[model samples]
Target chain A: MSAELRRLLAEVAERESERFARTHPDDDVLLYERAVAPRRALRRTAQASGVAAVAASVALGFVAADAVVTDRRDATPAASPSGTSLTPTGTGWTELPEDSAADAWRVSGRPLDAFFVPEGPDEAVLVGADVTGDALTTCQVLDAFARFQMLADAAEAPLPEAPLSSQRLGGFHGLGDVGVYEAEFTRRAGAAAYLALMVEAAQMCRQAVGGAAVVNVEEDVAFSAVAGGGMRVDISRDGTDPWRLWVHVQQGRMLTVIAEPGGADEVAPVITSYFTAWDR
Target chain B: MSAWHGVLEELIRQRRSALVGYAYLLAGDRPLAEDLVHDAIIRTFSRARRLENVGAAEGYVRRAILTLFLNNRRSRSRALAKQHLLVVPDVAPPDDAAGDHDVVVCALNGLAPRQRACVVLRYFEDLSTAETAERLGLSEGSVKRYVHDAMVHMRGELGDIDPGPEPTPQSVVLVKGGAR
Candidate 1:
């Protein structure tokens, strides 16, 4: 075939692929309808599967404190362990090499939502949906393209701090106006240890908080501690340290779901994986 | 609800193969593609109210499928990976593209997701640069640069069409000319 023909063909395939990816309106509408009327969609959705629609998370075996039942309607307050301060840092983490497929950081299963954070000024964070938490505590999602660049910049060598046990916090930007009050904490597992967080006032988030007050939606920010059959355990939420659950969101739906210290083992790997897959 | 189910029934009558082909291209899995289409059909049954133009609904349905693909990609890599199950072909992955399909995909992969999106919208969907910019909510200039940069890369990687300046290496910091 002539080169022109091949070029035309590739263009067609590429367009076809792009068009296909963009055509989830059906799924979107269904999700939209379902999001609005859970009972009706739930019955239909569940009837198709012979199960019940997601109304709320059933509190499992945690007996330490009162666990709030979070239905799809509201997010439960994050039961963060308090007292010990959380200092944030992008240190000690070996960022993925650019252009390398983030296979190592790929998410394991379905999540409530996936987040893609921007890595650069290239693609501005176009969408922000989650209106929960302290307005100070929401995660940011950017177009995945810019995130690649940001991840590359963050890929710098660890700050001699091996495990970023302690570091001064600062603000960070994501979507316009949102300032991020960021903090990080270290976690120790069997043989390896890693860092986690409690973000408060930082760049994009803190900026958003300062500039304008956002219209708070009814969805209560939740951190449901789901026990996934395997060796998942809850840490003492006394603020010293606790396990982390990460959710990724895009457009307004759940995109990626992951857990830190994933697979009853390494927390950093899980955290890294969450960051990698978390397209904000 | 998807607004294209009734339309799809008619579309299937007239364009089943093409619709399936689009689904296959989107999901990379035949069964999953059919399931996507079926689900889209079901949802469109309810959403037909919001769909203004019956004739233009096909474009909307197409857009919906694309969004679903991205959502699925975002949600879970492994389970969503299931959507790409290989199937025998009527509409297989168009590997036998007459042009630089590999080049285009690779060049696209090189772009920031947004840039690639810009290129896709401008050339692939045949949208004007301004239309593409509006759709993506980006500045016209940004759209132009994305298209230019994308084309240049596509030229080098896919074919001999020299579109513009060479692409910067992934690791290099983009330097503005420092002629003081």
Candidate 2:
């Protein structure tokens, strides 16, 4: 064993551990009382009530999931089925229930229609759709590779050359524009590879905005799979330029929502609502 | 509600700092480390029967943290692109003095997840090779290989850090800098 390596490890151990311990300075008593005690009580209560408690908890969980979905749609304007013509069925394409939020943003006055396309033999389903508006003009489905190239250029991050099918679905509208952008590609590559590409694009955006008026940035901003693995990048300066840049991924699908901070509803729930239904 | 609370509270009182430090070592990010510790505490207390002592509970909780961390590493969410997970929101430029720390962490981050875990457990936590293998559910020889590989890589990245002492018959071999 190299003596120098041991010394470095020891230094890392001492420095990092000390910094963590010093900075955290959390209270043990509060944690026990606040976090541990409640769970303990719940366990006891559940044990005693047995079937009733179990039933109640299940109901509560369902209600929670429902509430989450509803809250997400609160800000989304209901889609007027009047404007959206029904696509003929049996093309392995499933029409998304008219979502007002999906219908709100437009490109060249055409109401962007959302749907699911099942995978076909010899090709993964091109769940071909994208949101292109003020912020997402660069994110067109056909230009995904160009978009990745652009992001790599801006962020100085290494990115694989966009897949042959790499189609850019949307681009950032501006500093404070708010809108929803969704894109799915049935690449020759697997879902995992697509997911990686989407995540890289989001990360590139996050890195590019480093010098901008980013007030708060929460990485790995969520824990639940339902929230769609995402990050919340809050950009505000002087309490005026408040906007949220949310980039979320599920399976191979990528959803990015840019919204004014004070908007009535969050984009997370809306994305979750659509994805949950798609999953079903 | 359960005897576990009494045991958990006592353990927290005694070992909260150590637990949090352990998590920080594994996670690198402070907030995630704290969250991991909190989650580990809840999980360890929630599932285990009332162990007789704090030492036993500490062991349970630490193992839970390691298991959770490793499992999380393998989980799909972290695969949010290869280096993307390592991307921090850069609000300000980092100071020059922090270079060594970042270098070490970057090197550490470069290791495969299991290798990183084995190295942390063996060197940072000062666990014996067998104990690290047991904790990770890997063979001792695997642990040695991981350590050896990790050390060799770190030396390349960091330039001649000490790899500590040679292995006895009972201990696993720790590769020195000049070996490979």
Candidate 3:
């Protein structure tokens, strides 16, 4: 590097450092603890449990574990099955893996990925979407979701009491009159970002009046068997379409299931079957 | 907390400014840069229980910061691309009022993430090609290519303006936002 270049770099670095110090002069310790303590506790808990706390729950068929790991080896991109239009367009949208869901829903959109709409007997569509950008701003993400729902406005649908798990990502699944919805099934960089978005959603939900918003974050994750790196399911309401339940799962990736609100007994099987299709 | 924890905490307090600056270069935005550094420090301390060496701890944290920035950038590209698919106009106005220092920062930002990282690591941190590659999980050749491309970009954008002698501490006035 030239002498001038080095001087410029140093100047920029020094000024930037000073700006950070001035703005966050007192946050070093608090930020450190907030970032480290929970992670350390999670690590200790995982160590004590032997296997991941959530992976064990996956064995019970309570939730679908193991992020996008299932689809990596199956490089064979199948043709879009009978009912869906899941073409891998040039715009970088990955082809949806062949799944039972493919038989019933047509998928569209990029990044938001698959926006499924049921084609035959299936009552709901599955949307595999992701919130990506410079930062995953909660308001922006919620806005995008709301914007996409151009039909009836999506209000903050109250999250049902979800089974809590000790996995890297929280997952939720629900089936009721409010409309079945599951969200945050795929893991991301970490659970902190996931939790942050959820908190933002909750706050927005609390502030929303007369259900003006499209989706709402659920509350009360039941804290028991939900303790593995397994996925937890949270249900949000699609007020625009109440008979159809919306499932949004975000872990490292995102998987959503929109199904007709059905019996409580049918919730688990329906969700697991969708996961099976997602994996296939 | 152990005595080691205290040592780690003290080290963080002392070097937080430098770490935040390094992250800001990578993340372009101030708040996101702070979040990256914060997460990197937490990750380093949480994983390395036996923090016998503060220097190595700093290095580990720096690497974590780079990885976090890169991962977020990659994910953001996909999301931004997808958002573009929604028939929205995504145009950013060029910096018209950038000062000399702001110009330098903007030039650095223009490079692709990997190339920009190479410049920061190789030139700013004074890391060797081998070390940069190892830290980035890339081969030395790749690091060299990135640095070469970055330098070409810097030279093109920076031209040959003389920055004069390094300003003394008292001479340099620290302002609020720079190259933001």
- TM-scores, all models, native as reference: 0.32, 0.41, 0.44
Of 1 and 2, the candidate ahead on DockQ is 2
Better of 1 and 3 by DockQ: 3
Which one is best on DockQ? Answer: 3
- Model 3 Cα lDDT, one tens digit per residue, B8-100: 677677787888888877776765776677667766776626777678778778888898787773344333422321222245333333498
**What's the candidate order when arranged by decreasing lDDT?**
2, 3, 1
DockQ score of each predicted structure, in the order shown: 0.06, 0.17, 0.19
Fnat of every candidate, listed in order:
0.02, 0.34, 0.41
B1-180 in candidate 2: lDDT tens per residue?
A: 345656767876667667766776677665566556666676566442576678888988888788777767332432332222132334533333366777877888788767788778887777888788777776677677778787778778888665675432234444332101
Candidate 1 reaches a DockQ of 0.06
What shift in Å separates residue A263 of candidate 3 from its native position after superposition? 31
| Recovery fraction of native interface contacts for candidate 2 | 0.34
Interface RMSD of the candidates, in order: 11.3, 10.8, 9.9
Candidate lDDT values, in order: 0.33, 0.47, 0.45
Write the residue-wise lDDT of candidate 1 on B1-180 in tens digits. Answer: 233334444553444345554555435454566555544443343341455444565665555555454445332433343243223344445444435444544555676655555555554466776676666555566667766676666666666654333333232122232100
